[model samples]
Target: MQKLQFEALRRIGLTLAVAQELIHLLEQHPGCIPVRVTEVHRETVRLDDGTQDLPARRMPSLARGLADQDDAVAVGDWGLARCDAHGDWWLTHCLQPFSALVRRDGDGLRHIVVSNVDTALLVMGLDLDFSLRRIERFLALVQASGVRPVVVLSKPDLCADMPRALAQLQARLPADVPHVVLDGRNAAAAEVLAPWLAPAQTLVLLGSSGAGKSTLANTLMGHAVQETGATREGDGRGRHTTTSRSLHRLPGGACLIDTPGVRTLRPDASEASLAASFNDVARLSLQCRFRDCQHRGEPGCAVREGVDGDRLNNFHKLQREMRRDTLTALERRQQLSEWKARGRAGRANLRAKRGE
Candidate 1:
């Protein structure tokens, strides 16, 4: 048996901890090969063993015994593969991911965007696609995923007033959340993002279409690895160029995953998770008089007094969405009457606060 280069595996973002985990799993299942899932499709998945792109499917028995979608193959997942007598490979078991980017869809089920991510490049074009609210949403999702976030404000050259735009973004965000304003098409991205893109690190680009994610991915990769598309002239919204989440080796030994443009990201996170993203608000809430204060008409509500009104509204809006998502369809239907009443009451409270 030929020995394997664990260094080759590290080039694909495999850390020493994961290597030991793979070794332990392989110890139990002899003759099984460890492969990283780079691309997952409807029927088949693409595997990378640090040597070649081996297209593989799940073993029939393994496929039948799948617990849920999480057990299904996905990019950034490490899987154990075994070759049959005919020499065809089949992915048998998926190893646990150290970190994962996940969100809840309208169905309220967790959708794992990408697994084993070290850093997330939260891209936002300085063009019409820019919004602080959207950035806040991404922050919640990233924080919940336990992945560090670096806000990449793409296409600075396109902004009419770069300083004003930057100031507005910096106002809402914390001072500690590092943000970089750059033209993603140029070579400067590799330098500006160097802190997170060191060798053996794995970074994922996350943003809406037309946010210059694919362009940055190509720039960092030192080639046109991911296809770039232009945003519409009207709204500056981009088309879906990268249709799936796929990982590729970068020029500097780190790996990058280019995900399809997301129209919306509903964080499948708890209120504490939401508060982690909005630390300023959370800190203010600690000063509130009541322990369970909702910040509406409550005395000594620091959140109402200190926090910006627009941010407060946004926080409440997301909280309502999360609460609604937790309810089942039947429960939602049953509560539709009281839900409308609460909406009316909430609006009345808002109006009262404004009139105050």
Candidate 2:
């Protein structure tokens, strides 16, 4: 009985410590729940509890308020806020993240997909969703987010020859990284991912629909909390079963955030993510004849020579795409800045004309 008491106390203390750390990260926010946000109504949010309804005002997230509201906080973050005297909750702030999976918004602002993520399970089903280009895009996003990316090949049951598909994926991935192929509905699959399932840790699933992201989240939860759907026969794309981002506590004590599978993921690449994701390309670029060589039909393009022609082409293609995305984002920001400047100037002119 004494040992049991000690263990209970220890657990409580550990939980408190984790909470405190998050609070500090949130700049000592007063009233936020630890759970993720699913559906945000005008005044409330539907959490995973299925019974507990959270007041939207009480959930402080990065998406809450900022100059760039388009890049709002995502589902998998640890939030900070407090309940008022009336038992109403109001979100005040959110904990800063160690690493975040971000993508640009339609307005060209950066948006957080998942925050404080330790592991990003880059999921792709064995069916039509499996594409090297898509995987590379995810890799860039993972690299940029400063998180470890583990390729998870889901829906093994759907694939007639798992080994062959796995082999193809393996050949495409960077040699240094690891990949896991598993049936998303199986508990044994979670067991394979146990290394990352540490207590108080957070992991997020990043994959297209039909890759079994919702199923994997269910497996980790030891029950079904999310909806699952079948893939389209024409293209093998799964319907977006999870319309919103939601967090679930795993049976193993790890936290898992399952999000809606985006049809297109536009990445906001950093130099580090670029280097890490495309190490081969970066390494070869150093040997180029021209310092500013774009590697496009340029003579003495080291990147083209060092890597396989196909691999180099793909690398250049992604790099070009990232550059284009970045430029577009920058241009959007510039336009906003100019508009704001014009507003300020207009106000100043009005004040000057009104001067006595």
Candidate 3:
């Protein structure tokens, strides 16, 4: 009976490693059963026991024990649940996800977008909503999470210059990263993205609002599973059609998670991850004369000479943002004081030189 149950869970994206982990967990908690989180609400989560969906709340102690609020729970998390005397299911233990897509907000809070996802469909509209910089940012975040990223250029039918757009993408993105152009509403989308939709695979659609993520999700699911909305005429930006993140079982046996469009995506990545994302700039930096070259008009700066000015500048910006996020409260205050002191000293020198 347990083997049958395990088989059912495997059909819903349970890997061998996770299954082994689950077996250990089951031994430790004989009263608890394994459940996969499908949707997470404010106070309750929707869990699947491979047969039925159950609305379960976290145990009070479980919620209180978590150090970070983001670690509480999220869609795609595999956990242990138990039914109480009142016939209500309660999630007691959350299994550590092998891969998690995380983003840090401006307030320095980490938000786990999705857990245990194998691939990220980095959806971007080919219309005015397209931007190479935004694609780079998404790529960085996906790579940081150790999830494979496939660039999906959505709404190809709506694009006026498909060739030019494709050319731009090929020129900017890494050659190894796969990208495909497809109209999400067309049935052909399934065929185009078939390579990544194999059984037991899990994927997440990530893009801004109006990027055709829902449309793609519906097409891939072979039904209207998610709602679609039109883009604004003035800006070509999408409306918030998907208000929450939810997982759906694809006919091909893979699991798909559709997320609400993010307004701000500050990647929760370290300096090493950022460097890996900007491989060209990082490689060039190694050849620079100074080990600590800022590449801002510095002598023998290979990065400044070799990389595109805009691309290099974006790398620098993201690097600074990553460093700033790692700083402590005291470190931030000291950095601010140093900046103020430098400003004051520079102003004084200018005044003296001007004979003030």
Q: Highest lDDT among the candidates is held by which one? A: 3
Question: CA lDDT of each candidate?
Answer: 0.85, 0.69, 0.88
Taking the tens digit of each residue's C-alpha lDDT, what string does model 2 give over 216-263? 888888888999998999999999898877666676667777888865
Q: Which stretches of model 2 miss by more than 4 angstroms?
A: 1-71, 306-311, 325-356
**Per-residue lDDT value at 241 in model 3:** 91
Per-model TM values vs. the true structure: 0.91, 0.77, 0.93
Best prediction by TM-score: 3
Query: Of models 1 and 3, which has the larger TM-score?
Result: 3
Quick one: how many clashes does candidate 1 have? Answer: 0
Please list the residue runs of candidate 1 whose C-alpha ends up more than 4 Å from where it truly belongs after superposition. Answer: 1-4, 68-71, 328-330, 340-356
Clashing pairs in 3: 210-238
For candidate 2, the TM-score is 0.77
- Ranked by lDDT from best down, the candidates are 3, 1, 2
Tell me how many residue pairs clash in candidate 3.
1
Q: Which 10 consecutive residues of model 3 have the lowest summed lDDT?
A: 1-10
Number of clashes recorded per candidate? 0, 11, 1
